[model samples]
Target chain A: MNLRIKLIPYERLKREDAKKLVKDLKEGTIILVDAKLDPKEEADLIEETMKVVSTKFSGIELSSMELSELKETTNFERFKNMVIERIMGKKRGLTIIGPAKIIRKIEKNPEELLLYM
Target chain B: MVVKHFRRLKNRLASAIRKVFKKKKEIKIGLYGPVNSGKTTLANRICVDWLGEELGKVTSIPHETREIQMKEKVTIKDNGRSLTFNLVDTPGIATKIDFEDFLKFGMKRKEAKERAKEATRGVIESIKWLDKMDMVLVVLDSTRSPINQVNITILGNLDARNIPLLIVSNKVDLKSSSTSRVRTAFPGYDVIGISAKTGAMVNELYKMVLKKI
Candidate 1:
C-alpha cells in the first residue's frame, strides 16, 4: 500500500532543494510520518512538491496523508489513534505526514516502522 | 483641383464598368488542424491579404480560434463578381484538461481529472463539424514533437470522409522545426512547410487553394 510522507514547512525549502530530495526519495519510496503538516501555508507547495515527486515516481500508488488538507483536520490524538487502528499488523510502505524534516524519523528506523505499520 | 476631381470620377467609372463584367465563384475555405497547429495565423493571413488589411488579434495559445470566423471580398481578377468566402476556424483537438474544477478554491482530484477529460471531449465534439466542410487546411506545428494519437485520428477521419486535405506545416522559421520529419510522419500525404510569420509559401498556398477550388 502507498503511504505519503508529507513535508511540512514546504515554504522553507527552495525549489532546487525539493528537487534533490524528491530525486533521492525515488519512486514508491515510503515515508513514515508522526504528524500532519500545516495545510493553509503550504497548499501550493504541496502541488509543486507533488509535480516534482511524480516526475520521479510516475504511476506509483499513493495512500494516506502526509499533510491533512482535508476539509476537517484530524487532531493529533485522534490521528494517532486512527493510524494505530489502520496500521496495526499491516505491512505497508510508510510516509511522513508533516514537514520535509519529518522524513528524518523514517530515515532513522524505517524497518521498525515497517514492522509496526 | 479640377484635374484631381476628374481623376477620381474616372476611377469610379472604371470600377463601375469592371463590376458589370466580373464572374467568379465564391469558395468557402476552412482552416483546420489538431490543436496548436497555427490555423489562426494562416486564417489571419488570408483575412488580411484577401479580405481586409487589418488583422484581428492573433494568439499562440491553443483553442484561440474556438469559433468559426468569416471574411469576404470580391476577387479583382474576375471583375467585381464577389468571391465572398467564409473561413471556419474551429477549436483545437487535445487530450483532456479540466481547468474549471481546478480553478475552484477547494476541488478534489477526481473532479480535476474529470475536468481535463471534459475539455478533451469538447475538442472531439468540435472536430465532428468537419463533415460539413468543403475543403480543409490541416495545420501542423513543425517545432513540436512527433505527431501521435491526435494527428492520426484527424487524418483518418478526413480520409474516410474524402475531404480534400492540405497539410500546412507552420512555424518553419523556428530553428528546431521538423519539416522533413512532419512529411515522414504522414507518408504519401501532400504537405507544405511554410513560415507563417514571414509570409513564405503563403502565395503558393493561395495557388494550391485556387487549384483545389
Candidate 2:
C-alpha cells in the first residue's frame, strides 16, 4: 500500500475549506498540520468528515495537542502564551488527521500523540 | 458615567427579554458524548428518576442508540424549584465506525455491516442535532483519558454555540475510574463524577443540572 503524509502549515489549512482536506483524506493521504486547530475548526472538520462518510470512507481519526496544554504554566506565562497565540492566530502545537480505514486510532497524551496504523 | 449607566440598563433589559423568550420555548437538554461512554445509561437514569421510565436501550455495543430518542416534559424538582425540559438522548458521536469491530461481539457479517451503516448515519444525525440543544451533558468514561479529539470537538462546539454544558465523568463505580483526571483535563469546566449503573451521586447530578439550566 502506497502511503502519503502531507505536512501543511496552519496558515494554508485556515485559508482552505475542510472539504478540500477531506478530499485529500479520501485519496488515502494522511494530513499533518503544524498548529493545533481551535475548537471551531475541529468541529467544522468533524462535520465535513461526517458528510463524506461512506462504505469505503468510514471517517477520519483526528487528534491534536496544544503546546500550552503540555506543561504547567503560571498565570503570567499562560497570559503571555495566550497573547502569543492570538498574535500568531493559531495555537502552537501539532495536529494529525488520518483516514480511519488505514489508521486505527490516534491516541493522545497530554505531552504527545501516538498514531496506530 | 451616563453612557455606562445607559449600557447597564440596556444589558438588564436584554437579559430580561431573553428570559421571557426562553420561557416561551421548549428547552431541550441533550446527552452528547463518545461512543460507549454510558450516555444512554445516564439518560435512562435521569428518565427513570423523574419520568418513571427509561428513554433508550443500553448496551456494551457502540451506537446502540442510533436515533435521537427523547422524553418530553421531564421535570425534576429540588427545594421547591422544578425545571422541565425535553431530555434528548442522542446517538454517541464517533469519528470512525468499522464493521469488523462488531464482528468480534459475535454478530453476523451482514448484521455488523448494517450496524456500521446505521452508526455512520447516527453520527451525522447527532451532529445535526447539536444546534437544537439548549443545554448539554457531555458524558465521558472516567476510566479513560479525557484529552481526546472527540471530547475537545464536542466541548468546543458547545462553547462556540454558547450552550451551557456539564461534563459527566461516568462509571465511577469502576476501580479504574478517576474523576479528578477528568476534572484536571478540562480545568475550567464543571465535572461531576457518577455511577449511572449504581445510581451513585445521581441526585447531585440532578441538582447540578437544575442549577445549570
Top DockQ prediction, candidate number: 2
List ranges where model 1 is wrong by over 4 Å.
Answer: A1-117, B1-27, B53-56, B72-84, B100-125
Tell me the TM-score of candidate 1's A chain: 0.29
Docking class of 1: incorrect
How many clashes (backbone atoms < 3 Å, residues ≥3 apart in a chain or on different chains) does model 1 have? 16
List candidate 2 segments past 4 Å from native.
A72-74, B1-21
The model with the greatest TM-score is 2
The sequence of per-residue lDDT tens digits that candidate 1 reaches over residues B13-102 is 543453454334344556666666777787777777776753445654344454555555424223233345567666665422334435
lDDT by residue (B135-200, candidate 2, tens digit) is 899999999989888899998787767677889999999999999999888876778999999999
Q: C-alpha displacement of B71 in model 1, angstroms?
A: 2.7
